[model samples]
Target chain A: MPYINIQITREGASREQKAQLIRGATDLVVQVLGKNPATTFVVIEEVDTDHWGIAGETVTVLRERARQGGAQ
Target chain B: MPYINIQITREGASREQKAQLIRGATDLVVQVLGKNPATTFVVIEEVDTDHWGIAGETVTVLRERARQGGAQ
Candidate 1:
């Protein structure tokens, strides 16, 4: 069984969107690796902005800075 | 930055348990790879038993069979 995990910023997706992601990811794995869809697992996690960081700044801070037109 | 995603069967852990897992995973990545904790991301996803399978059987089915003492 192949397990796929997807992470996105908090409140970034709707339930329907997440379902689509799970289905698409599973289909891709099955197409490429010949894995059984019934045996494949897909997990989607929504992370709080403060708990996710890039370039040493949390996503919360990055979004705030971007809103104010701050330099990247 | 190192990103870690942890998956577990749904309803199998508590909030505190997940926090511990996040901290431990982040610390291990930092210690082994010299990754910065500020930029490290950890996401934990709890998948429904129906969504997780092994050996062509869903975890829900497996648990049910085990409860009845059925052959694996």
Candidate 2:
């Protein structure tokens, strides 16, 4: 069984979008790795911006900085 | 950089537990794979029972069956 985990910031993604992600990920693995869809597992994880870090800074801080920079 | 994602059913885990998971996973990667903890990412994903499946049945259904079997 092949397990694929997709991590994204907790932006407001709809259930339909999540479903599409699950389907697309499964399809890709099946196509590229010849994995069986029945046994393949695709999980979508929505992480809070505060908990997700990048380059030693959390996404919350990074996004705020970007917004301020854009307004300047 | 090493990325580790841990998936568990949405069973009301506390923030402390999640933190422990993150720390433990990062330490494991550093000790075993010799990855830098600073660049190591650990994400904990809590999934709904309905969305997780095994043997063609969702975890929701499986847990219910287990409870019923225990009562009988």
Clashes of each: 0, 0
- Candidate 2, residues B1-72: lDDT per residue as tens digits? 987767899878876666666767777878998888778776666789999999999999989998887642
What digit string (tens of lDDT, one per residue) describes model 1 on residues B1-72? 887767789856765566667778888888899988878877666789999999999999999988898776
TM-score of 2: 0.55
Name the regions of candidate 1 deviating beyond 4 angstroms.
A1-6, A11-72, B70-72
How well is each residue in A19-71 modelled by candidate 2, as lDDT tens digits? 99999999998999898999999888789765565433455666899888864
For candidate 1, write residues A1-72 as lDDT tens digits. 999988788956888999999999999999999999999999986887655545444566668988899776
Report the poorest 10 consecutive residues by lDDT, candidate 2 chain B. Answer: B15-24
